[model samples]
Target: MPDTAASSTHLTLLDDLLKRALAHGADAADAVMIRSDSVGASWRMGKAEDLERSESTDVGLRVIRGKKQAVVATTDLNPAGFDELAERAIAMAKVSPDDDYCGLADPALYATDLQDLDLDDHPDQGAERLIARAREAEEAALAVKGVKQSEGGSASVGRTTMALAIRGEGARFEASYSASSHSVSCSVIAEDGNGAMERDYDFSSARHFEDLDSPADVGRRAAENTVRRVGARKMGSGKMPIVYDPRVSGGLVGHLSQAVNGASVARGTSFLKEKMGQKIFADGIRIVDDPLRQRGLRSRAVDGEGVAVRRLNLIDDGVLQSWILDTSTARQLGLETTGHAGRGTGGPPSPGPTNLYMEAGRLSVDDLIADIQEGFYVVELIGMGVNYVTGDYSRGAAGFWIENGRIAHPVSEMTVAGNLKDMFRQITPASDLTFRYGVNAPTLRIDGMTVAGA
Candidate 1:
């Protein structure tokens, strides 16, 4: 929960807005309010480059008349505009085309109790502290051996308060929650003095500032990564196993989530549309979406639609189990809402995963790649060359070459291509999973990928 007084005030405003909608002949209505504040600082070459702060309050209201719906948003908080906003929404709904699936969550499905997830931990660490953090990171990076120059270091702190209210049949639903984030990032260039140079970056983000990695550590990591990529060359084209480091392996899991989104499934735009209850991954693979994780980057007690949310095993023992779904998409697909709704002031709610991750596998990273005579250990991916409709995948890649079961040298200007269905079936995860991002996975090895070098 956020500040009790603030939450109460936002809820009251939303409730009043909903009442106005109902009074304007809307059958049902819902409203959401978001308040956010953030501060950021950037440093380069021992000097502060920039420091900035922002604050905003925005709201969205949706009204439904029979099967038609309309959504409106505003940054104006004056109560005097509530009547016009409601009236505009009601008029739009009256003239809008019917959408059989448009409506609020069922009253019975609304989350009644808000649980404390320990998401807020931002204190009044002012601009001076932020600048100090950024400067420390940049200075540390420049201290690393083989690190030639600094790109920049940045630190940011942010807090958001969200409230949702729904008008139901003789019942009213309202909920409020708050979260805070702190992050530090450093990017630098490393050179071998033979004109070989490469750039890399590292960052740490957490709900609590205490949980974030120290500025020095982040800078050192960024420098080390950049140094390793110096003197990079290209590996010749071949079809072999491709190993994805933990940092980039999460993308594979994210692709799976997108394929299982109810919107795509309903529209037949996902290659996995027919894969429900089928073995989509290797045996023993499990993927989970948990919105209730205490300190997770995307944790939430309830979904954006004011529906109760729980952890879901999206994949259980390699079998596809559930689609990521919001209310409208679930209705269109003739299934119940999976409570994966994500909302923004400018658009209607849509399905998305929160705190999604694949469970770690049995083998260590060293053991997982022990037998690979030739492979690509991918560290970075570029371009969005994925075709969700066909599951065909291709991407520009840069990483190290694995030769004779060891990382040999840095490689660049490469392409990795394969169908996702085949790649998913060949995935072998390692026991190196870490919860450092919204979507996470262990280091993964996928066999039979086409690796081409320029």
Candidate 2:
């Protein structure tokens, strides 16, 4: 049982520790404390199989003296342990390299008006309850006719609190988030006894349990998806239009986003380097990275480096607008930080996007497909083969064959290859956009992709 009251007290203690670190030896200090609890349950063969519940807290201290800086973290939060951690961090900072850019963020850049977003409010669902839900989902999937084996079904709940404090600057912020997820997967042996096809469906709800999809719904969808792939075959190789379902399109967008990070740009590993203000995509394509999306999984008032977050237009009407940036990478490139820093206690902060999404187009998925005579509607991809520097893109894909504006048959064991530069310029998005994850996009169609199949 986790006590919210105790968590709040611990957060205050962490703030006090930051002040103490600055007083002890560090010219500046920042502290972060995170407490998280999670419950997970899995079911197989229509019965509860695995159940897990865990709670943990981690505290990190970053000390800076001029250009020298060091970070130390520990799961121990006891009074003596906390004091020792601060001392160790200060001592480590003494021997660190003097990089002129390494220091706490300027006080002027700190966020002041923090929003009261309730990210951790959820009904209490015990381990038994989660196991029951998992069993129900598994049973529902097994009930579908022709379903041969259930891979597994699961339900999970998680709660997390994050607190940060910067000394002297007197900036502090705390936020919490709660989430629940349910997933089911099933495999069906084809009637021809030649192959087995597996598919999965998952639904995740944040902030409230009522937002979650029903276990039966997840199970039924998993079964339906598996059945549809029972007779999958290979198609002949050729250049054709490729339609990507929303789930697959999101991943494709993620790869592109990674290539636009300031770190990649500074390291000369991104193909988008020096392409700012240039046309990078089709005329209708637009992409935005918004950190203020209400109840968004990645939404935060301040970035990891304590900079206020804001919406950024990475691409507007096909033109490259800006690259995602963190403090260090931004300074390296002589650009301002874009409030995209993502930090963990284990490593230095890195640039990242929050709630990155592609702007939806006006055409529906069906309407987008109607104009294509032959294509592949990609549902999933396997293996990463994208080259950020050269912009060469190739991936193993599985999907359904689209013929005459309708999905005709399932296809598998194919490779789709194209250059990122050309792919971005030729891609088109459908209007059926759904916000299911931190990064989202609508179904997208790419013209003239080389499909390598039998």
Candidate 3:
């Protein structure tokens, strides 16, 4: 656990800033305070390459006068700077444009429990240790049979402490949280004897150092994947099932996130704007946003607006059930906030997801693809040719080909095109869901996509 006393100190600063804003002729206000420490190192070709470390503090003040709000941020936290910053913010609010739906969140929704979420960890390492990690990872990758050139291996770690405080009509409170992370990665090229080459990479991140994958293992995985990609050929143009590997499948769910964002629905620009309570995916499909998950990469004890966030069943049994909503977006659509408010120093609250993932289905990956006579198993997505408003999807893709329910040669330089609305309805998941990123899905299969070829 992070030092409770340190968090309290930071929270006090935020509390004082909010009070200062209210004292300076603002009707209500909130403040964000952050402190961070980071370190990184890199190595290549059996030698140390570089090292870096940094520490910083940032504080931002947002003051509301009646229906207007203004925000200001600074790295200077001097007592003298605090008063001037708050006074300036209040002054700016007087000339700001008015908004009917802008203000503090409903006081009743404020978070009270702050300590139960385990969002912090301790990683004790310096330049020497980081460099050693990078060196070992690169060495492991270069040891692989067909692995040739090293793109370098790297390691990084960081710690951050954040606090938010709010003051309104009769409500006043503050919440603080801390986060720590450690990660190692490697990228390398694999060369075939006939002068063909391919590159791939793997990485792992965790709140605690001990939870990270071994450096050697990360490097080995990267090299193995790259070596497997050597001599990749092209497939023919046709309509076929496109299976998404776990590494890249999360992006499919990300598209769903954007479609269901309340802001898009409010503006009538999302393809899924009118899809509420409708069956949008195959039966048994479910997606969730969980903010209280222990050590989650995007977990938060309280939301960006000081509201108590909760787990949301965004998609329930293949039906579109909810929109990711913040206080303002929800009001625009005549609904309650879904506890998805996210904000930074100089902007209004916006809807966002936290620890989002789709539930696994009942079939193993092998079983899921056993019936495919010919298909493409995607490994990497190259560009963003997505149209959220029209639901059109086109992107450069590379992966292996599946023939007669078995893996064939690797394929590259292909384009997959389809409509997301149609793609969602046809997507079938395999029971291999592993929580590896902020957005995660298992091996997924989509039928009837037009795969453009060489």
* Window of ten residues with lowest summed lDDT in model 3: 113-122
- Note the Cα lDDT for every prediction shown: 0.93, 0.78, 0.89
Q: What are the TM-scores, per candidate, against the unseen true structure?
A: 0.99, 0.93, 0.98
How much is 226 displaced in model 3, in angstroms?
A: 0.1
Query: Which candidate would rank higher by TM-score, 1 or 2?
Result: 1
lDDT tens digits, residue span 1-454, model 2? 1235764786678777886787778887777776777888888876677888888888778888778889998987777667778888888888988877666565677666655444445557588878877777777777877677877778888776666666754544443323333333333232336655556454555555665677777777677777777777898999999999987899877987988999899989999898999999989688989887766667777777778888999989999999898878888888888889887776567899999999899998989999788999998898989999999999999989999999999989999999999999998998988887788999999999999999
* 2 versus 3: better TM-score goes to: 3
lDDT of 3 by residue, 227-328 (tens): 999989987999999999999999999999999999899999999998899999988999999988888888887888888899999999899999999998
lDDT, candidate 2, at 204? 51
- Residue 230 lDDT, candidate 3, scale 0-100: 93
Q: Count the clashes in each prediction.
A: 0, 1, 0
Instruction: Give every collision pair in model 3.
Output: none
Which segments of model 3 are wrong by more than 4 Å? none
Top-lDDT structure, candidate number: 1
